[model samples]
Target chain A: MITVTGTFTVKKNKIEEFQTGTLELQNASLNTDKGCIEYKFHQQQDAPENFFVYEIWDEMASLELHGASQHFNKFSKLLEGNLDKELDIRIYNTI
Target chain B: MITVTGTFTVKKNKIEEFQTGTLELQNASLNTDKGCIEYKFHQQQDAPENFFVYEIWDEMASLELHGASQHFNKFSKLLEGNLDKELDIRIYNTI
Candidate 1:
């Protein structure tokens, strides 16, 4: 299995707006992808403006496919002007 | 299943040290807990200093148990002066 994690910084007070768009993108991605094991979004209680996206896929290929899918492209583009800072993304494997 | 996501902000340049401690704590937690399905940490490519911790447990109770465990407490304390900001923790359910 492969896991992809993204830590996003929404503009100081723009969390709600960002989440509205993010949820739509996440739901669409999860619903359409067979390789997705889990896709979840979280916000820290203490730092509400910071967000995290956690995803698990069946394999590296599945993850690559996810990156290449239309839904992700849409999501990526959606971040263009909405982010307070650049998105942080990382991939990992079971240790 | 219950998913716990934590967005942590390590001191601007303390990511490596934070991760070393985090990995040890995560390994200990996973090895000792039967309910832990997965525990993974990720750093974004665009923002390398940003980190996310994703965890899946069998249920909310299990997740609660994890939070009360020694490993977690140890990890929490370890973050005391090492963080640049407060930790972000959130819980989510599969929808």
Candidate 2:
């Protein structure tokens, strides 16, 4: 399995907007992607603007497909200027 | 629930040792702690020396208690000098 973890920092006061868009993308990924095993989003408790996304895919190919999906494309467009920094992503494999 | 994400970098040539110790601690935490909801460990694919730990507890107090548990203390001692860097932890709440 391929696990992807993304740490994101949202623009000030934009958490609600960011979360809504993320939920839309997350739902689409879960429903439309055959290999998406898990998709979960989390918000930092101390710093509300920080977000984390944890995902599990069957393989690298499935993750690539998810990146190219329409919902993801839309989300990328929506998040263009709403982020505090570039996404910090780390890909992992179960040990 | 309280969610904690910790990023770790392990010393070279010590992943096997680290993983074994970690698995022991993880199992102990899961089986012995009533508040531990989930405990998962992941190894970075590109950087095999790096690790990520995802944990969920019933509340802040449970997390505190877990930290004080014997298994955790033993694991901490085992991890001393075995890690390339201090654990970078972030606390989050599901949104």
Candidate 3:
């Protein structure tokens, strides 16, 4: 299994849009993607604009497919110019 | 519930020591701590020295207790000077 953690800092004015878009992507992955083991979104309690995405995929191929899914692609596009900086992404494996 | 993500970059010579200490801490939390919902440790696939600790607590009190636990304190001492830098910790709440 592979785990991915993405850190995003949303623009002050686009918080609502970013949240809605991420909710859509998260729901699709959890509900329809068979390879998705866990797909969760979180917001920093002290810093509301900071968002984090934690995902687990059963295989590399599944993760690749997830990135290519229409919902994900759409959300990615929707997020353009809505972030404070480029997404800081990290991928991990069981120790 | 509160979630915490901790990023640690280990010293090159102490990888084995750090892993063993973390494994001990992880096992103790999962097996003995009643309020620990999730206690997972992961290593970045592309960066062997980078470690990530993902934790979920049932309440703020649980997290506080966790930090004061004997096992956790012991492990923390074991890690002294074994890290490349101070741990980068992030706390979050569900969106």
Q: Each candidate's TM vs. the true structure?
A: 0.60, 0.95, 0.96
Sorted into a CAPRI-style docking class, model 3 comes out as high
lDDT by residue (A1-95, candidate 3, tens digit) is: 99999998999888888778889999999998869999999988888889999999999999889888998899889878888977998999877
- lDDT head-to-head 1 vs 2, winner: 2
Better of 1 and 3 by DockQ: 3
Better of 2 and 3 by DockQ: 2
lDDT of 2 by residue, B1-95 (tens): 98899888989899888888778888998999879998988889989889898899999999999989999999889778888888899999876
Please give the lDDT score for candidate 3. Answer: 0.89
lDDT (C-alpha, whole model) for all candidates:
0.75, 0.89, 0.89
- Using TM-score as the measure, which candidate wins? 3
Write model 3 residue lDDT over B1-95, tens digit each, in one string.
98999999998888777778888999999888869999999989998789998999999888888889999899889768788878988899877
Q: Model 3, stretches more than 4 Å misplaced?
A: none
Per-residue alpha-carbon lDDT of candidate 1 for residues B48-70, written as tens digits (9 for 90 to 100): 55667778899878888888989
Which wins on TM-score, candidate 1 or candidate 3? 3
lDDT of 2: 0.89
